[model samples]
Target: MEHALFDDLVQSLKEARAIAHGQMPASRRIKVTAPDAKAVREQIGLSQSEFAQLMRVSVKTLQNWEQGRRHPTGPAAALLRIVQSAPDVVRKTLHA
Candidate 1:
């Protein structure tokens, strides 16, 4: 590895350690909010089973998201955002 790149990685590790220890503040913070599953399903006029099928998830998984027992992460979370913002497009593309 290049000397400069190695030094940067070491610095990053130190910074991460300091942040974890609460000795230093993060340079930036990002907050992601999950969409409400039930609301999105209702807005799309789909029942739980239909919505679960459309989302490619089991009804229990959908229920967990709706009931706040579990939260969707990664791609599922992104899909929920897309569905919330553009229900018609998703319904036309995925439901049809």
Candidate 2:
């Protein structure tokens, strides 16, 4: 049983190496377009300070995003996408 488990582990590692080296094609690729932070803010009719406050980011960070000097990632990026898709829903949810 122990030998079987080791064999399975070795097979898994080999598959992983193949995938890493592009010997195996990935099943699918997900493409996520980063939101246009400045456009989102303008569409919502919020000033930079207000938008920054609502997004829970520092003004400088928001400015960076707006200016394309930096990009938002992780949860912040996710939230911005949500806002872009459903501005009213996000506004109601956040303001509520």
Q: Pick the candidate with the highest lDDT.
A: 1
Query: Model 1 — which ten-residue stretch has the worst lDDT?
Result: 29-38
| lDDT per residue (tens digit) for residues 12-85 in model 1 | 99999999999999999865567999999998899999999989999999999999999998788888999999
TM-score of 1: 0.65
